[model samples]
Target: MGVDIGGTKILAAVVTPQGEILAREKRATVAEEGPEAVISRLIGAIEAALSLAGTEPARLAAIGIAVAGMALPGEGVVAFSPNLRGWRDVPLRDIVARQLGVSTFLINDASAAALGEHCYGAGRGVNNLVYVTVGTGIGGGVIIDGKLYCGACGVAGEVGHMTIDVDGPRCNCGNFGCLEALASGTAVAREAKRHVAEGAETCLPQLVGGELEMITAETVFQAAQKGDPLALEIIAQAASYLGIGLANLVNLFNPELIIVGGGLAHMGNMLLSPALRVIRERAFEVPAQAVRLVTAQLGGSSGVLGAVAFALQQEAEVRP
Candidate 1:
């Protein structure tokens, strides 16, 4: 069993040993309702997935959870989650394990996704790779020598928090000018809103039906697709920042591949082309020439699939 706990949704799946999903279930996270409520929902989703797969809890090998935060895998605690309101030092893994009577393991969502991609998606057969997910915020998973590196603190893949500009806008992590604060979907929408607020001559106001609050990164992309000058400018700026961030990763890791995924990845070449251009222009020639950037093949399924991969990896490590 594999569960992905996001800010707004809980997705559970029954995955085969061969990395195929047999059944899946999804439920609202309702994170605002507090930890107990969110835990209940996660359990419910797991049960629903099990039922759909016609498998009993006792028959399952283990359950792996992918959480969007700093998860202390050794302690079974989710130390903190920016997206999940009110979560602090929560013993999520133990709680789920006790309730379901199944061995449970916790992994950072991005790390799990990286494992998933390496095992079954874009990074398959690649020895070294970096997976960057750009969504509401940015996150990353690093693979070195074909192994996932969680750093000394298990918070290793926090590529989003990398300081891009020391004097740029403040990020939720209290950092100024982080790559995430500049290039994430949230950042894109924020910049677009600023432009609209300044009375930039764009159709964004009309597109959102005069409600600035409804403006989103997707809206900006839509307008940019239609040649809206302001929208294009916003996307270009964000893409440039993303390129710089990725270039930094390339220089640091010198990975053979970089898999770009997340909600923002749906923009495809519209987002990647500009970023690639910047990477080529700025990154070191040797690493830049050796690296190939590609979109993630697993899409939204990456998290749950990654959870399964984590569970399987744990099982292997414990054997003998």
Candidate 2:
């Protein structure tokens, strides 16, 4: 069993030993209602998946939860989640474990996605890789020598927080010029809102019916597809920053592959082509030439499937 808890929704799945998803369930997080409400919804989702699979709780080997934000997997605590309202030092793992009388563990969503990609998706058979999900925010997971590197504290794969520009816009994480602040979907929309507010000449306003607040990264992409100059420029700038972030990863890890996922990846070449060009211009030639950037094969299911992998791996580690 695997569950993924995000800011907006919760996903639960029953996965086979071979990484096949047998059944799954999803529900709104409604995080603003507080931790208790969110936890209840999470449990409900898990039970729904189990029911969908027609399996009893005792029949499951384990449950792994992948959550957005900082989770201390070893400690079974969600130390802090910027997106989960009122979630701090919450004992999510233990709570779920106790509630269902089933073994449960926690992992960062991005880290889980990385493990999922490495084990069953884009990074399969690769010894070193990074899985980066670019959406409302940017998150990453680094696999070194085919092992997940969680750093000294188990929260290491925070590629989004890396500083890109020393003097750029502020990020929700309170950092200036962080990669997430400049290249994420939120950043894309933020840029568009600014342009629209300034009365930029583009079809963006028409796309959102003059409601600047309705502009989103998807809206920008839609406009760009129609050759809206402002929209094209916004995407170009975001992709450039993304490329810079990837270049830094290349120089730092020298991974053989980098898997890009999440909502923004839907732009395909429009986003990746420019980013690849920037990477070639900036990163060391040797590493740049060796790294292959590709889209994730597993889409939204990556995190949940990764949770499944984590549960199985942890279980194996503890088996007598």
Candidate 3:
């Protein structure tokens, strides 16, 4: 079984080698209820998925969890997390291992998604790949020589947090001018609200009735699709920043492919077209030609499937 424990939701699923989802379920994290409550919700999700899959206890091999924060092996503690509150020194792996008597592997969500795509999705045949996600925040994962690269301190491929501008907006992670703070879904929503408050005539402003509360990323995307020039500008700027970020990744890693995922990627070619243009225009020739940037193929299942695959790989290594 595999679990994706994010700030707002928990997704549990039984996945197969062929990327098939046998069964799955999800629930909100409800962090306001505290750490124990979040753990209970995670446990409920696992049991529900197991029941839905009709898998006997003996047949279940292992469990993998994709978490949102920084993690270290053997400790099972989330050292730092901007989204999940009161999660310091939390023994996550130990809790799951003791409660279920199953070997549990923990991986960050972005890294897991990269592994999943490399193993079964767009980067299956590629020796090197980077999966970048633009959503509530920006995130990325790196795969080198067909292996996930956690780097020193298990924090590699954190391209989103990389400083893009010295005087840019502040990020939730306390960084200034990160690509995420500039171009994330949340960032776009904020920009929409700012334009509305500034009396910019936009469908986004009218759709939210001049209130910033209901202006979400989805709404902005819809407005852009309907030819709202302001909304289109916002998305283009985001894609431009995303493109620059990718170009930097290309220059640094020289990967064979780059897979974009998350809600923004759902904009499809509309967003990718501008991003590709910016990347080609900015990136060096050799790295640019070697890279093929594409959308994520597995859709939303990448995290859970990647978690399962990570566990399976660990088990495979232990046997011989």
Candidate 4:
């Protein structure tokens, strides 16, 4: 069983060792109701998935949880989560383990995705891989020599917070000019709204029926596809920032592959092509040439599939 606990939703799945999802269930997180409520929802999601698969809790060997936060696996606690309101120091693994009567393990969501990619997705057979998820925020997962590197505190793969500009716009993390602040989905939407507010000529306002708050990164992509100059400019700027951030990763990690995933990846070549061009021009010549940049193969299933991988790995480590 694999559960992905996000801020707004909890997704649980019964997965086979071969990465096939036998059954799945999703539920609203209702995080604002506090940890206990959210945990209840998570448990319900798991049970629903199990019922759908026609399997009992006793038949499950183990459960893995992918949390969108800094999870201390050793402590069985979620240290902090920006997305889940009021979430701090919650004993997630123990709670789930006790309720389901099965061994449960916790993993960082991005790290889980990284492992999923490394084991079965685009980075399969690659020893060194970097997985960057570009969505509302940017998150990264690193596999070094076929091992996930969680750093000393298990919060290592936070590439989004990297400072790209010293005097640029402030990020929600209280930093100035983070890669996330410049290139993420949130950034794209913010930039578009800012430009439109400043009297930029574009059809976005009309598309959203003059609701500025309704502008989203997807909106920008859609407009750009139609040759809307303002939308095209916003995308170009965001892609340039993303390219620079990716170049830095290439120079630093020199991984065999970099898998770009998350919602923005749906933009296809409009996003990857420009980022690749920038990487070739800016990153170290040898490493950049040696590295292959590709889109994620798993898409939305990466998180749940990754949870299963972590569970299997944990079971393997304890067996011997």
71-111 per-residue lDDT for model 2 (tens digits): 99889899999989999999999999999999998999999
Per-candidate alpha-carbon RMSD to the true structure: 1.0, 0.9, 1.4, 1.0
| Clashing residue pairs found in predicted model 4 | none
| Top lDDT model | 2
lDDT string for model 4 (1-320, tens) is: 98888888899999998889999999999889988889888888999999999999999878989998888877879998988888899989988898879999999888899988888899888999899999999998999999888898777889999999999898978999999999999999999999999999999998899999999999999899999999988888888899999999999999999999988988877888888899999999999899888899998889988888988988889875
State the lDDT at 90 in candidate 1.
98
Q: Report lDDT (CA) for all predictions.
A: 0.92, 0.93, 0.86, 0.90
For residue 53, model 4's alpha carbon misses the true position, in angstroms, by 0.4
Model 1 residue runs over 4 Å out of place are: none
| lDDT at position 285, candidate 1 | 94
Worst 10 residues of 2 by lDDT: 311-320
Task: Please list the residue runs of candidate 3 whose C-alpha ends up more than 4 Å from where it truly belongs after superposition.
Answer: none
What TM-score should be assigned to candidate 1?
0.98
In Å, residue 296's CA in model 2 sits off its true spot by: 1.0
**Model 3: per-residue lDDT, tens digit, 266-316?**
998878988888889999998998888899988778889888888888778
Global local distance difference test of model 2: 0.93
Question: RMSD (Cα, Å) of candidate 4?
Answer: 1.0
Models 1 onward score TM values of 0.98, 0.98, 0.96, 0.98
Between candidates 1 and 4, which one is better according to lDDT?
1
